[model samples]
Target chain A: MKPGTDWKNSYRANVFEEIPCGIVVIDRNLRIVDQNLAFTNIFGDGRGQTCYEVTRGRHTPCAECLAEQTFRDGQRRSREAMGVDPAGKPVHHLVQITPIRDETGNVPFVAALTTDLSATKRLQREYQTLFEKVPCYVTVVNRDYRVVKANTLFRKVFGEPTGEHCYQLFKRRHERCPECPAEQTFLDGGSHTSSHVGITRDGTAAHYVVSTAPLVQTDGETTHVIEMALDVTRLHRLEAELLRANALREALVENSPYAILILDQRRRVVLANRAAEKLWDCDRSTLIGHTLPRRAIACRLDEIVGRNGGPAPLVDSTIVTAKGVEIPVRLSGFTLHPVEGERSTAIIAQDLREIRTLEREKLDAERLAAVGQTVAGLAHGIKNILTGLEGGMYVTSGGLARHDEARVKQGWEMLERNIGRVSALVKNLLAFSRGDEPKPRLVRPAAIVADVVSLFKELAEQHDLVLETEISDVAPASMDAEGIHTCLTNLISNAFDACLVSHKPMCRVLVTLREENEEIIFEVTDTGCGMDYEVKQKAFTSFFTTKGSGGTGLGLLLTRKIVQQHGGSVTFESSSNEGTTFRLRFPRRRLPPPVEEEHNGS
Target chain B: MSREPSLHAPRVAIIDDEEDVLTFVRIALEDAGFTVEALDRPTEALATLEAFRPHVILLDLLMPEQMGVSLYTELRASPVLRDVPVIIVSGLNARDTLQEASAATGAGPPAGYLEKPVDAAALLDAVRRALSHSGRGTP
Candidate 1:
């Protein structure tokens, strides 16, 4: 119960014979006077021998003996010491020495008590290794911002900073960093963070993010700061590069000529370029954050860009103008790389109004040229008719003077017929020059062909030429009957002329009418002099004619226009000296409605 | 205005492409007491001319196979037919045709030029003038 008195009295009574720790009695010369069982177990019963020589297995007094100091000053002292155990293995212990003084107050013997501290010291060494080996630079600084202590990492990276300020060692700077986190930590005794630029011991640049924590005293006095820094140079470089690339990409997208729209994965407009703003006639601020209106986009956009018909822009598409009119456009789309969280799409649109205008102007010019050519041909044709009239009148007057009734009747008939021809020529010329769209009505093409064939039959007498027709009975279909009549007349006349110029004795002109594949086909062929390549190439060109003054060259052009209005086409094949065949095709379902100007204005 | 067509009339060869024009003109000139031989082809007219030995020729300028200007040139080159008067009748603009014919034949147009629907008067006038100018039909 009485620990000090009982335990001490017993140890003194038994002359330190028994205890858990090693006990020894030493004199002023640091020699052991007495030994106990624990001391014998530790130092091997070193009695009447120097304590250092017994415990350390040394032959001389040990350096800095704690018992010598205790004996000289008549005091007790304790220290951590290293010595050998009974097996001669190194042992770590806490050794305490007390002066055992005589009645005259002079110390003669020093009793030493030792505790084994090998396990605790081993744990402390492990903790110190962990602190030094951690990858990041770690250091403790005093209130003066000087590096008070540095770990192995800090010393390796910044060089040994035994007494130098942290800023001086890390950055080679003479003054403290303006926004030092360590200074803040010392002021508030709280953790602070900062990013800094510094240099390494190898003289290479280093970027670091430092976190400073207060190393507070037990009484909460913040006299020092512990700084832990993470080298982040690579991470900073990567972040800066990403920012520059983003800026460059934004610049390119914003400056594109076509309407550029960046859309989020949800198909909402994330951004709109300047062109997009003008094309949509909306401010970028208004359009950017909104989903694009469906009508403002083309339906064929998807088919233009990707497989499986994903969304994009396209040609033959119409864009809704600011005036609410739909104008045709050529559109294109691009799929941008998936960035961050969403894949984006971009669209571009080019307006086609100028092209359409140019097309219309070209058509108008062609029509005007046709009119001019038709007028020239008209003058020549009328001149022929006038000559015929004059000859007829002379014959009839002479016959009348001679009182010859038969000759007079023949001449009168000739005059009447020429007048009829002039009227027909005028009618056809008027029809062609009007330049109105065809009016489709139900009519039989075979009838029109027969009618055209009957118009010119005098060729049999003058030339070795023959005309024939092979017509198939067909149902009445939508067509411009009068226009077809003109077309047939023109073709038949041309065929007859071809037959006339052919030296072949058996020259023939054949007209065919039939229905094939729900389309009506009218073909006129001549086994006469065929057109050459140059003629065929210029067949549809305005005012290109080989018939000299006899042809207006408007016939085929008018035929083509009328056929086109009825959603049909006129094509021909010809070879020099072989033959010629022209075919006009009219699809039954696609005939054009009457001309806009043809209806009564009233 | 007939000067006097003798019982043996001066021969006129007519070459034209149009049959109707040939028929009507032949009847008109024949009734006017001139011997007329009509050929519908200028290519055939040269053969007909050799047989008929016409003292005068009426040529339509725009005949196919051979133009009248060229036929006129051929007649002037021949010793037998050179003295025969050639008159040009065309339905084309007469002044331009005459100029073209003159330029092509390298002879000054023809002995006479007539634009068609040459009435009986114009046809007879041009034919008679051509005959008189060449001193071929001096009835």
Candidate 2:
């Protein structure tokens, strides 16, 4: 059982027959001398035929035949070859040819041991396809920074770079990029990544992120680098657009006229604009990372945070600045979502101090104008009284000189009448000129109407006028109670006079009180002699009276003043010889605020 | 200032809303020997004025029910009274009231303007001057 002899017998019986790869023997004449089963299975029995005829179905010996070289030099040779099988299907194999010599060691045959490599070749082909068809640019560069190899996508994007430097092929630059990742990989034999702008075949810029990996030799020497570059031009464009939009938004917020405050979810001020700092009389550094300036703004922000996404209506509020000065402001709020799942609240405050001041000045100007008009009317009234006094003096003196008793009595009567008128005029003037703020209290409007009505009820009855009330239950309001009483009394007394002047046997006076549209309304209707065109034209003017010698002409004026103080209006409709209806409308919201009890007590 | 009334005494008409003014003017004119008619209401003054056929007319600018300016305009339009000299007496400013009345009525200014508190002497003087201006003074 010697090893060498046993192996030769085993090789014929088992090794050669059972081997998975194809094997064949050929002579110097280029004929197939012997073949293994694996070879027969592939080429289908090639005995008595040339090796090229069995493997390639060729009639002549193949050019550059490895077995012919082995037979001439008595050496061994190997090569990978492609041929057709029994079924004419493509086969790939690796052949090893060794010379088989006789005892003389000259002019010998060769055995070509073939290994079927069709499956391995198929796998290699698939891998090659994958490498070429990858979406990104792949390049293999040598130590000199030249692209030794490139993939299909690289060739298409950068144009075939046979021996061109990677920088020149990818960036169209004659010099290497300063921060080249491939150079770093070559230095350290480690992977590196960097972003670059490459030029495409179409002469357009292509943004890419390139990763460089060292292709190290067995000796651990870094010779070349493999670069995998992902095109990110679209992502870069998107990022640039987003940056522009963010910058524009920031500019708008900073330059807005109204004060803007952005509060994070924790109700801390994350951002405050220049206007906000100015309004609060503070610096942005002081405001940032802090809560709202005052309770008013904080309360509004809290309320808006509850209502996600939309804007809150503007509300009148008061804020205290850093210097402790209270200012009126109109506040509006919005809930903003700058990012998903993150919430913020924005408050916009509009300063109303200037507007309030303007309104007050306008009111003062109107009041001054009214006072001027009233003074003119006062002059006219005083002159008329003076004329009456002068007439009395002239008649009394004339009658006394003549000793005419009847004329003297007549002149004395004139004097008395004028003196009484003067007293009345002075009293009414004092009342009209008393420009005091209203004393507001919580009182029922209907009660004031009822009080005035009751005061005039007996007079109305005596005048044969049917006086009635149509009062509905109404809410109490903040108002000047005595002022309202005076207004009602003036209106009702005028109604009685109108009825008397009508000379009608039966006259009706109706007073009604109601509430509607958040306003209190009182209306008085009289079936009495109404104003003519001239009387109506001068109804609200100074010292213009229908009741000559009886009216000081201050009743309507005082009533109007009182109504205006209560933030109410007086309007009347009258038709000559028919009737007059006067309306007093008071909106609840506009009514004067209630006076504090302490002040009232004082 | 007593004078005897004669048949040729200049007749004067006074229209005013104030009864005291009307009475005083009437007595003053009567004592000066001019025949006078005084009416308190402007509504009645026009008819009474036409009936009295006064040589001069006195009008108050402000009156209830109707403005005296309008009454004066009506009197000017009256065929019989259009020639009578009309004087304006008002509590308002005399020149302004007269100008306003003249502008509003599109008529000539009144014979004289008198702001109120006008005394008896001034009233008599104004009346006599108006009568003379109309060429109807008592001889």
Candidate 3:
């Protein structure tokens, strides 16, 4: 083996073919003289061919050829060049050109080394696109809080930064922010996030959340920070509106005049207004979060929540306070069911103490007005009676002065009749003004009807009226016997007077006693002169007399008073020229309590 | 004044519900030299007054069978009795009632008013004045 031959073999094996680059040797005339395997694989076997034809697919050399410079200066030159393969596909590569020297050291050929860089350029383009078109405003900041680079979105919002601080661009602040996440990331070399209000180029505030990551180089020193800020202005506005609405609702519930209480599904009080506190006679703290006692509400919770498919009906009831005092109230309740969360019930209560007091006062006023009317009526009745007396005196004295017998007789009769009227009026007045409470005892209603019938029988016969009695089996009721008797007597007498004035030859009177619907009813029906509109309107009101000098007008009034005391009512039906019916109705439940029984020891 | 029928006496009508009131008022008017017709039932008063054609009428406002004011309305509406002078005598406030009735019916007021319990002289004086005011005074 020769020494030179071994060295050439080793050079081809180790340097020319084994290197991962395409190598080509070219003459000073831009012709390919020799090539490696990588060169042949890239340019497709270009032995003894012009370099421009093989690498550029051109008949002429490149405009700025580095191989010419290398051959002219006998020095190496490096550059990036775009060339094509035999298939006409362009390739990006870094090429280093060096002149090959002869034994005299004169420039003869140039060796060009090519490294393909297409994959690295594609990766660089992808990274730049991602950095420019991302949805967030991305920026790179240095240790001085200055913005070294900014993304497209950041430039659109804050304009171009000429080495300006990030605080100045993002927040338009002259000084650094007090609580900066970027500063924290720089110190700890960790990621951090914060929220801030930034000013856009148009001077509008932009709400954003910024996440900062420290950019540590190979030396592991955090020299820069990458900040990604997401715009949240619309979300911020929505949050503020929601808070305002919630505050308004709270204010409305707090200032309501009604006693409002909100209860959870378990019937525990959750919220109570000021009015509710006053009505329940308890503190707000005591009522809230506490289940009300059963006696306090005086009703079942289920009934209030289930009735009417909505709010419960208002009910007049009594509620016991914390102090065991009873308070009258009108109560109502409603339920609220939400799509999410527990269902609740709201109770509203109104204090009825003031209303009850007002009702009582109104009753008293009406009574006073009735009394005043009675006094006025009494005065008028007395005036008419006095008028009668005076007229009698006048006639009697005048007849005496004239010595006339028939005139004196007429005058004397008038005087006697008026005197009798006066006596009757006094008796009726005494009975009416007595106002004594009835001493009730158990008495059969039929017996009372029978007595009334018997008493009126004689008068009926005299007046040619057919008087009858109807008695049905009825239970005994507690009643004032004498008071009932007086009532019956007055009704019978009035019926008799009605018949006499009717001018009808045939008139009937019937007194009925019966039981109906747990009530004892005594009705006196008379076929007589019924009242007219004017008379009926004034019938039960005052001293209205229709029987000339016979009626004192206190009969029905006294009857009504007695009936009221016995917890009964008197009603009448009358029509002109037809008849009249006076009904005395006594409900069994409303009758006075029976007198206590006493027994003597034997 | 005496209880004798006189042809020259001024005719008078006394309307009341009470028999005693009618009797006394009639007697008093008759004693005062007037021919009087006493009416106990107001339902019958219109026919009687139309027949008697009295120079003066004494009306009681309150009555059971019919209101005297209603009867007064009929009298004032009557062709013959409309011109007759009516003196209201009642236990009620007859003047106020007449005014109220007049306001409603658009009729003229009564010639005179006398409340109940009036003296005989006052009643006679009222009748006389009414008769005089109506141009039918008794000579």
lDDT leader? 3
Q: lDDT tens digits, residues A177-219, model 3?
A: 9999999998889999999999877889999999999875547
lDDT of 1 by residue, A1-602 (tens): 68889988877767556667888888888888877787787778778778888878888876777777777677788998898986889999999998888999999898899877888899989967866887888888998988888889888766777789888888889999999999888778889998999987788878999999987555777888889888898998889999999999888877877777777766788888887777778788877777767777756446546544465545568877455777677777767776566667777777677778998999999878766755655665666567667767877887798788997998897688678767766665676667786677777778888877777666554675677889999888777888888788778877777776667778888899999998999999998778765567767754444553345456787788788878989999887667889999988777665443446657
Instruction: Record all residue pairs in model 2 with backbone atoms less than 3 Å apart, i.e. clashing.
Output: none
Ranking by TM-score: 3, 2, 1
Query: Which fraction of the native contacts appears in each prediction?
Result: 0.38, 0.73, 0.77
Between prediction 2 and prediction 3, the one with superior TM-score is 3
> What DockQ class does candidate 3 belong to?
medium
In angstroms, how far off is A279's CA in candidate 1?
4.8
Order the candidate numbers by lDDT, best to worst. 3, 2, 1
Task: Please give the lDDT score at residue A148 for candidate 2.
Answer: 88
Q: Which residue pairs show collisions in model 3? A: none
Model 2 CA deviation exceeding 4 Å by range: A1-257, A260-328, A337-341, A431-485, A499-508, A511-522, A532-542, A561-569, A585-602, B1-8, B43-55, B68-86, B94-101
1 or 3, greater by DockQ = 3
Interface C-alpha RMSD, model 1 = 4.5
Q: What is the TM-score of chain A alone in each candidate?
A: 0.47, 0.52, 0.51
Instruction: Note the Cα lDDT for every prediction shown.
Output: 0.76, 0.84, 0.86
